[model samples]
Target: MTTSSNSSLSDVEPSKTPKNILLLAIGSMGDVLPFVNLGVGFRRHGHNVIIAANTRFRSFVEEKGFAFREVNWDMQHEWENTDAGSPFMFDFLKQGFQKSYSNSESVLNNVDFVVLGTGAAYMYPECLFRNVPAAYVCFYPWASSKSYTGAAYGRSFDSLQWLPFQLNVKIWKTIDQVATFWSDVGLLPIYNQRLKELGLPPAERLPWLPGGAFEKNQIPVIHALNRNLIQIQKNPLNPLEIQMDYPSLNIKEELKDFVPPHDLVEFLSRGRRPIYFGYGSMHSFSDAESRVLIWLEVMSLLPQNQRALFSDVGNIKMKELDDAIKSGRVFIIDHIPHSWLFPQTCCVVHHGGSGTTHSVVRAGVPSVVVPHFADQPWWASILHRLGVAPNTGIQANAITTDKLFSALLEVLSSEEIQEKAAKIGSKIKKEQKRSPVSKIVAYIEKYWEKTKWDVLTLDDEQQKVKVKDNWRQVNGNCYGNRMMNGNDDMQDVYL
Candidate 1:
């Protein structure tokens, strides 16, 4: 492992040129796709970029013409086999972390820099020990900031602005406890033991703790949501949190020579702009059939002039939908790029995965977000807050045919909703002078330069103190007053 001398940001140049970059990402297609897009951008900028992810995504990664390293965990299999309510879910996550860390160690010796997703950021201590410059790229907000409640706790807080600073802190700490339960049981001991073997000090705790990784490392944290979509807040907490445009990979040019299914094309061409329904990689519902039934019922409620398209990626079993298929009212698609398909749709209905939410926003189509789990509800709230989707999007566990029908009807019938979505979409398109991928690459380059010579490193204790100080500064003035007063303008604050 290389060690850096204590120096300032401008003085510590290990190299003058960009080095071979290793991008580590894990999770659903939503998590992996943006990194793939970033890898393409890096490659275009003459950097040797390689993506390390689950073994299942090897073909997907290689198809994009980048080197791929298998991380040896299949999230789909884990999701399918493990019961949602079971404690073994943590064990599944633990196994994934272990394998990803091991795989990352095997490859890091050859890489000069690293880009990690929030799931993979736990390896930052390892990167620090190796003196490898690393930064985190997130699809959603991960770090705790006064600008917004942490995305992990988005479901818990009804109105963050109404809560006091201490209460908000307690909310985050409680969330940390739940996350810590998983880490302490599955990852911490193993990681610490390995650190001992490597002759490096063990981490005090998991990095996901507030002020743990983001502040401790002080690395550039890139958030890939459109700036326009993120509600701006006064005195935002984290100076490290950088907002970049969501990277929507241009698959259209690549798919131009390719052909889409004739049935799908014909269905779209014939319908009065069909509504799209897809729960990408989400299968957590206890009653899959019931959910499908509700969707079918919602479709039945629609006028004969309106149509619906469903992506059969998640728990929706298509064989059981033979009746709907034969009736030609609902079309089941295997896998299609939202970039290509969403533009043709009148509206989209989906589990609010970050990737899917951005696609709907980019497509400028009004949506009914039926969130299944984890950050989906948060994205749903953002959509609703932006007026692109109806308020209080149908929760997965609470979803009913009536709720679906009503939400769909409201979006489809509201010219204001349609217009709002289109305006937001147009604004996003206008800001696409550089792709989100390019912006990410540029940020990484800037990070490399800024950190190459920095000597002002903070130890764990100092980092914790700094975090407290920063929080105090944010909560001391008008920000705290507005939050405590339950000001209506609080909702307008950007995160």
Candidate 2:
């Protein structure tokens, strides 16, 4: 076939910019940063991005070079203030759901697509109810054959035997029921107030993600984490891996010129490959004094050759660190980007957060996991079984130097643990190049090309799974009911 020379030589622009995309998350730097990396990816690919998250991250989002859209999910703030104070945590979940519902339109207005983390997926059904096309983007797999969150927190974490498929169905039904109650009553009012403040319309319930309103089988998901260790392999791209080419934040260079508070720099420089001791946004200590005491206790347990860098992310005052802040063995700083800090450390002493876990594992350093609650414990268990760290997850309130020291020593002195960590680190170094955002963009592009911009949603048959009420019967209401105790006046945040 012959073609005209002018047609062959004509310059053509790339596809039109993708309609607005809604990016959502909750809590600290962990929940937010990965999405920012994603937003950077979308922008490079000619997509407009808007972030829907708690207001606390507004400055951090802007700083990272992305546009920020605020949502009224204040659970992290409430948790930080009240030590997650029982019912407060329950209410926080409720409020987050309500806000997610109320903010749907704002999130969907003129939106061509959506990408969300684990926290955002809980609200995905509502987007479907609103008839918005969406995809679930995870840094980690949600459906591992091993103890995934849906199975573990579903009251089956300890069972030695694999759960029957029917049993798994029942487990999720109970969780959805418990979750719905929290969303409807416990948190809706908070959501309403936030919407009023923002001058955005309140969210109304809609069909859930990729199913119900959308086709179940047509659902598109982009799982960002490395595939080798992931237990489940359901997606089209199992072991989905991509080359990551993120621009460096260069935070170290920026911080190098600015003089840190007295003794901070000297202490950081003086440590003999010190372990970092901070819980990110989660508070392991209730009061500054107690936090300081914990620092002193942890420091006392470590040999003088090793030191501890305490991050005050929860607003932990250095004064509470007391003498340790001046002890030349301890350094307290407000924040340091994990991307820059993890590579330099000999070991990481952390709260077992998923993001932190991924960072340290990628750095290939051994860890001392002091998991407090939730998925942190689950991650801690995985690391311990893998021989990457010693299990140090005592109740955050009960941690003492003796307990802390025992866990820290195992990682620091044991060649086996160090070797294992180094091995995992080598694997992570290879996997880090597999960028989650790029894979997601690729999925979207392929979908767009196949559908010719016609949005596709999941179908019902794909969504259908056997329901096992018996699973709930065995678990005995795993999420026992508790009401929020709002007037608990004790308020403090510790790093």
Candidate 3:
């Protein structure tokens, strides 16, 4: 709908042929937001884009005026209580998957290709069933080899870094298999059952990444990251993967101007820039006690004249935080674009999520990372390794008030850290001109070539098939597409 005057995707126009691209964006707000960013990229490139995600995000996706399909996964609950149950609980995850596939007559009817997020790999069989080629995308690496791996590998194998490279690779890959052991166990039976129903052969087991189905087949697997900022341990033996700069809002989406609330604007107009603290979507009731204690200490520790902003209010109310907010010592915000807010911050202290890490760097400010789990610790280490953050960072479970205060002070005062962050930020801003999304789109179009026919008809097909027609009253909402069963998965293909 709008474009930045210096848009990169505009520089290299999309091919004459437009595609209908379906994306699997299943996870928390942090996880699903990137896919929304990418979906808009495809839309700008003249393709029909559909985002399939959790029902919670239906309105979030539909607000962009794109067709949304629902597929359920309580990622937050899983992260909150890791020891409680499998993410693929039979009664929960299985039913959601089965319903989506049964409803595929709508979303998959004319979808040319899909971009699979890590959690949505189970949808591979459905893609295969519908004869659609799919690519893999993530904030971090996906397959494992002696050379490259997901950040979880590094966190699990950091102690054995002194071992031989190949041996370390084996350890990390083995750890990956072990880490995913439960998920693989839970997913295989359900996955195979779906494949059987599709008349496809059952898979023996899950691959580290769909058994390298996408990469080995030359379907691109993209890591939307800056290789320059994070030194990913590399090996040629790993499956071929492309590393690109993180997708930027102004560059990729050219989204409408961000308008901060008048009160937030007043807060910003103050002479001193505020410190930002956002723990992302990792809010867990299990750790809420400790999380609250840490916040209480943090609020009390805010320097006398300095300001701070928190993403949202903590669940168990804190008198110190409450008083601080009431007195304008802190501000609570929701849905403010990081691209707009980060530049105004003096510095950021946040959970080391993939998006927030890059956002901090791109904002050209120093940071203090408080990593919780998964790829988080690795990101903290990466920021330290790059001299953009103070140290390997304080883990959330292990964090102490003193350690946090020291880390914050270091990031705030260290000229070296600020300089490095700014330089990387400037470099990343310049390199975004390369347009990773363009490269991704080009690879799909060039390798997975389809004919130039209208939506229903493919050139040279034995039969000219007309797909289920438009506007099928989706779950009491007129979303201009077939609705999902019970208002979850869209009954029709995403555009």
Candidate 4:
């Protein structure tokens, strides 16, 4: 448990508190929802939190009673149009960042602190130039470490585990380079242009080096994962990482006064608890019709007494499945908050987005994760490791009716898995009662306390002097120099 010198900053109290915080969250609903919960926490504590996300989330963000800024990226459109296995996913992400940078400068001008998501790391160099304290909010582990396989790659190299640590690191670095090459090419030019406009030197054209954002900016990271689900091992690579419980905004209480559709309510009452199947925003399959057909086949294999609730949130067209909807065995819904619905279900099956994974886990329901891309497979693996899902779950490409039926039957019949899930759900409920937001707020305040003195006490000339000194220190080391030259390709090594 060795600590850094900045550990003292954890105790400092700021002379001036940061009132305005801009959280730039640019991804799927899964990515944005957690931040929305965090923003609610910030607002409760008297900070004016503005969530800058895709325009599609405007109503969702505004409904939460916080200021909303619209970024140019639409996750729904990208998800529906892009293939899950496309290498262009990283390029698309980079474009989103570029668009965000162009539109968010005005919003950034007013913010006292900036919190960015994992995909928005391109903003860190600019945050450094502006001297605004910034922290990264990651839903998954982004830093390079030896404790686990890199989350970005979504697979482990078990055969390479016997290799030396340095060799493993190099292998991981090479994998990242191949994965993120297009993203780097698309993003670096735009970022360099922004730096030039700000009267700063252009940043290095670095590939997406794991943990480079926090390392380069010397800021803490608020990781939004429960330690109970995923234990945080000390990453010798990045010491400033803070693991907090998942921030869940359960909307069930708010919906208590409201009424569900009459048919849906009746369906819930008529049968034993139904199984839920929804992919949320993932459109990995070729088309909605094909997915529905496969789902129908899978549902036919279920016991006569078991009903199913199918969500048509992404590309799935519920109208096309009129026979299933009319039969009363299956109910097709546009969208329902998982927090409100998952507990009522016997089990859940879906594309394993982080939000969906956490939601079903908290609901204490067994899961059948049909992973598409990105961290979905990794999360499915976690659920399996936790005994809440079948082994390895089901990969998207390999999903057949038989495989789906087998996996679903195994979980549904396993009393051990059910009991384990219930225990995990109990733990999650206990954690939810203990507000993760308050702890995060306190940590942010401490960050301000540590840096505010220097930022406030220095005169114009002294500030320039301090900036120069800090820049020299930041760029002096071999690692720093490599980062500056875009040569540092830090990688996570797994045993």
Candidate 5:
């Protein structure tokens, strides 16, 4: 198999013992799992690893033999407690922002490095100010042009989709201003002073930076994503590439008993080819009753020959499952590891969370995505565009039994969809060439070994000079670029 340069990074020998690592993701298990894998890989290589996330997964994390720090981001409770469903979802995000800021205040100063996901990085301003070296890992390909967040966070409606880029810039500008304002209020005016010292224009208002802009401010950032897939036409500042690849549970057969619901054997034996339909962590269907009715209606339309598994884990009550059970081909399960369950499935229907999207795709199953809010729609759009699935609008509410049935048939019946899915699956397999854990570990080792804490300083003038000299030598070795090189050199000097 042909391997890319990124895959080769992990193979480099380390020159020093690795440092303790902290990974903070305050979302669902899907949001936290890949980092978990990375942490596990770190520990395996003899570094201490700690994961901070929602308490819901505390037991799961400890059971995996890792330290679990609780993040009181009550995402689920916020939804359930909200008076209005859809609009209250905005409050839900605000609540998320608050919790993330608080969590960062508590942990940023202590960690050697931090790696965060999207909603998680909303707290990044804290880490950044704390002088912590950090990485932002966007699990999915970006679609928007926002400076920090990509189109992945924007609305799916074509009209509103363009708004994130425009709005986010103003919002980030505001956040920067807020940071400057808070600096005047508190003794830590270092960041604000630095802005002034650099002779940059003062921000109009407080920057909508993650975390209250209190703390140290000297962190270097490493973005981790696939650059090609990021939206460029939509947002011009799209060169950032962060690490991709979701973490695998790597749960062995022996560990099956430790997984939830206490009915492991029965869950596994239910069927070898059950289609899975469960939104990971985030619940898109606020109208539980309508969602259940739609789910029932859609399941009824699927061919009797096809078996499926439904997890109304966050919505529909267990007692309301009379119809779901009557459909002999469908099994209603509470929870099962998607990593394990997806491969046995003929196909999947899901809320396209980045983690779930990659897991199912890695399993090589043709799937359908009925997105529910936020990034899910972006995933649905991409997967639909990729032809492995039909983008059947947002949530089951927008999809009728006819729509659902057609989508199901489209993936299951179409040999073309199956072929395309297999082709995409092969590409994903190639993409997972090297484990992210190893690459991250290698990066840490190299950076630490060379300068130790000296690398912490923002100054790299000497290194910059050496890099320029080496580039000049390399240019001299290559043919016919003296004039063009002179232009680039002049531009670099001007910049």
Candidate 6:
């Protein structure tokens, strides 16, 4: 169940016992950045906060001055391009989950709240076991709703464009079910195995994706998105499934004095603001070299008077494109926060990630969204609908340098789109002063306050616990004097 919009933040009194808050950042830097910001909020509220993410992101997270923990492993190592009977990393789930459990549970000693990012669905049961007040944070909308639509497995809801609306959702659910089969084939065994080891009952697989049922039976779900730019469906079934603006700030107040390297600063001063071209962690699995060349060639073809910035995430060294880099018009950067860089650019060319889309819009700039896959085309459509991006958007698979150049030109030249972008930026800036994290932590606080329950930790030292008369059993799990059941309605488990 969701907390009321009227839940007053003032009601969240300073805790007599500051809780340990753990945030899991399982995907890319975009996924991790928001949590770091959230951790900063928790820190200010007099709680100990830890940011756990990929090993590679330690410095990035630590730079924000939060304690850090290495998650499963570096995402790149897991997703390394492999065609030798390993199309995906399903075979690696056992090692990964075990590693995750080993590393995470050790620090979860006092973790009162665990904020699970979009990709950390497997960790749900562990939270249940620990009885930690957990919440799921979704960056984009994938579940099918009658009023709003999104992409599924890199295909838009409109892929089955001719089907009736109900049929469309059914089709998406079917597709997600098949994908879930393969995914569960890898994760479910590990999940149940982990539970068995903990002496917990094996859980029946609950609805995860499609039909937007992922929110069902899960922890309170927060959709961190800008409502103004997104066309969410007409119906929102769950009051707890909240949608809020993606914070304009990705770092804390202490790190706000970020200095772009002197070279980057000099490059910006030398010419007109360069258009940015980047695809975060895109093409990490296949044809990376060819994609790199295509990106550079498009940057090279920019109007002679215009300059461009390109992110070389793949670290492909250039033999042929050396001239373009030497031309002083193209700057290749390894990593820079979009929070600082996007506003300096006249426009952006990106993969239309939820984070990047929000970043560019909040930076007061228009962009050309060249979506590669999953929620990207969805964001692209939102931009087009909002008139912040031109047309629908260019699909990455079919992109040509000429097509990219033309889209770039459209974004740069369109005054209407540019102005609308600036207005949205202004709104986000105003909201930033109020701090989304304050509201978020308050929601988290409100959730725990409403459900004043306790947990009996089931660990090696304590396989079972002696309980008072207040503790009772339901669905084979004990809740602290709470009455809940799955027999009636879509079950909300030991919540």
TM-scores of all models? Answer: 0.79, 0.70, 0.78, 0.84, 0.67, 0.80
Which runs in model 2 stand beyond 4 Å of their true positions?
1-17, 81-91, 129-131, 139-217, 235-271, 313-322, 453-495
lDDT by residue (tens digit), candidate 5, 25-116:
76666667777777777787788788888888788788778887777685655655654224124445655665555555555545666666
Which candidate, 1 or 6, would have the higher lDDT against the true structure? 1
Question: Tens digit of lDDT per residue, candidate 6, span 44-143?
Answer: 7788898888788899888878888777655545645423123235656556677777766664666777888876756765665565667778787645
lDDT of 4 by residue, 371-419 (tens): 8877777688778878988766677778888988899899899999999
lDDT of 5: 0.53
Task: List candidate 5 segments past 4 Å from native.
Answer: 1-15, 79-105, 128-130, 141-149, 157-243, 249-272, 284-289, 314-320, 323-327, 430-434, 444-451, 454-495
lDDT of 6 at 375: 75
Task: Quote the positional error of residue 332 for candidate 5 in Å.
Answer: 2.2
Best by lDDT: 4
lDDT of model 4 at position 58: 92
Question: Judged by lDDT relative to the true structure, which candidate is superior, 2 or 5?
Answer: 2
Question: lDDT of all predictions, in order shown?
Answer: 0.67, 0.54, 0.63, 0.68, 0.53, 0.66
Give model 3's TM-score versus the native structure.
0.78
Give stretches of model 4 more than 4 Å off: 1-4, 8-18, 87-90, 156-190, 202-213, 236-238, 250-259, 283-286, 313-320, 453-472, 478-495
Across residues 212-315, which tens digit of lDDT does each residue of candidate 1 receive?
44434456667777777674232133355566777665554335656788878888887588888777777444455766777788887889777778676354
Candidate 4, residue 115: the lDDT equals 82
Candidate 1, run of 10 with poorest lDDT: 1-10
lDDT of 3 at 135: 70
Order the numbered candidates by TM-score, best leading: 4, 6, 1, 3, 2, 5
Residue 27 lDDT in candidate 5: 61
TM-score of 6: 0.80
The better candidate by lDDT, 1 or 4, is 4
Cα RMSD (Å) between model 6 and the true structure? Answer: 5.8
Q: Which stretches of candidate 6 lie over 4 Å from their true place?
A: 1-16, 82-95, 102-104, 160-187, 207-218, 231-238, 247-255, 283-289, 313-320, 391-398, 455-495
- What does the lDDT come to for candidate 3? 0.63
